[model samples]
Target: MRPRLHIPRPHRRGFLTAAAGLLGAAALGGCDRFAASPMGQRTLKLGEDANLFVQRLLLTPASLAKEFPDSEISPWFKPNGTIDPPDRAYKALAATRFEGFRLRVDGLVERPQDLSLSDLRALPARTQTTRHDCVEGWSAIGKWTGVPLSEVLQRAGLKPDARYIVFHCADTMEYAAGGEEEPETDTTANPGMEARPEGAENQASDSQAAGAEAPADEGDEAQGIPVRYYESIDLTDAYHPQTILAYDLNGQALPVSNGAPLRLRVERQLGYKQAKYIMRIEVTESLKRIGDGGGGYWEDRGYEWYAGI
Candidate 1:
């Protein structure tokens, strides 16, 4: 039987206060445009150079939040968005208990790696029960166990030019119907979007293309599926002591609905930044070339790329 965990309401209030404070600061500084309603415009217009500078300035090793005795842990850790991915490949892996699942870590590194779940578990691990704060205004606390992202980067050996780490996910969002299909002539072509059911990916791709041409409808693209929920963190956040790739929760193997095989644990940011169904990690200098030049799937749709808190 699992132990009952308790999440204090006061902690939730504190988390909200901190988040609002950060968002408020961004707003006062004219950064609120990044978080503008996704249904309006779907792009971050901060420009590459300025965005890079901000990301650099925000980079800092994350300090671990204070921990509590085992008895104080939360009893229930509710699953976040898309608990079970609709992707067949992911479903198959889950059915088999992720026996063959592998995490590929590449890009801007001296050594690239393909690590299995067992391989990750064999490494030294860190465990902490921290609050999971969501952007939509909700929070939960869970005990996560995994190797520090810094440790993984060290093993991969980051190149000097590596400035950001991009997380690629397996989950693809379904968009509204209607739109023309364009052939993939370049890297920017939506790979995952194109693979979606007819009308879904095409509509999404068209909105993205349209958003690129006219910033007016960018909000529409934001309301739609934005490149499938990818996120990037600066080198500093990548090395934060609290930043981990969690594999366990509350002393047990991670549940399938809760990013069973593995998921990122970036405690300082909102929950959306903690991507699940992650398959690839790429190190890059700029997000301009990643997905629609927005740094993240959601960022491509107007969500802030540097979601600092």
Candidate 2:
């Protein structure tokens, strides 16, 4: 059964005024200071517990939002996070329309395989038009088409030790902590700042330019090396019928910015968990070894790893 998404309508001025007052108090009371101390960790843990409690009180389980009809869908669906890929390999793939792109499925599986776009398309497919909710307070609805992740896993033959699936992406975000570039490599292996196209480089120079572009729309058919943005979910979510490796939207191939060729669709969680530009899928028992011992790049910076809502 599809879960019903209950979005409370924005309250009028009275509610806003009251909420603002509370926010003002928290700000004045040294919210940042409390957030930085050991006491802050305890406070955050308590707050998270409260948040989960209140969320349960207000919204239905995400599993209920899984069912819907084609006629009722959101018209303007927006993409969230990492709209443009910065990796040179991804750019080159994008330039050629991802014709040579292949998705590598390995790790704790009986048959590690390198699959092309056509290979994935040939598998049994499923489509769903669903709402994507982000932690940053935005939402959009779009149609997604792809094979059930279960089918892929079954074909690959999961090893008994496989417990979590990890996504490795090509879309590397700028981590002020020197980003993902290997410290040992010199400029030769690393395409210096000079490697970027003139227009893209200019865009990188302007802060506003970064967020100006939205991800590709649902129907974009342009080919290129698909961008690299990977995400992962636990085995429980992996086998859900609603969880898929989407390749189409609005009855067409996914656009470049929208994760052309393939992207993950874990409907139970927030949008960030739904990784795009997926080139590889790895199955493992623990996330302790993946980026920074935190599960995900953002999680390393303190965002909750299990963002259930």
Top-TM-score structure, candidate number:
2
lDDT of 2 by residue, 203-307 (tens): 211112233222332212232323233456767667778889998877767766566668898887787788888889998878888876667766665666667
Alpha carbon lDDT of each predicted model:
0.64, 0.64
Tens digits of per-residue lDDT for model 1 on 1-309? 211222112244444444554544445555565445452122223333234344444453445555667776655555555445545567678778889899999998888999998888888788988888766655667788998888888888877667889998765444344443233222222211113333331221322422432122212343344344477887766777888999888877777656668889987777767877788899887888887887776666656676655
For model 1 the local lDDT of residue 156 reads 87
lDDT of 2 at 21: 46
lDDT of 1 at 92: 78
Worst 10 residues of 1 by lDDT: 185-194
Off by over 4 Å in 1: 1-62, 175-227
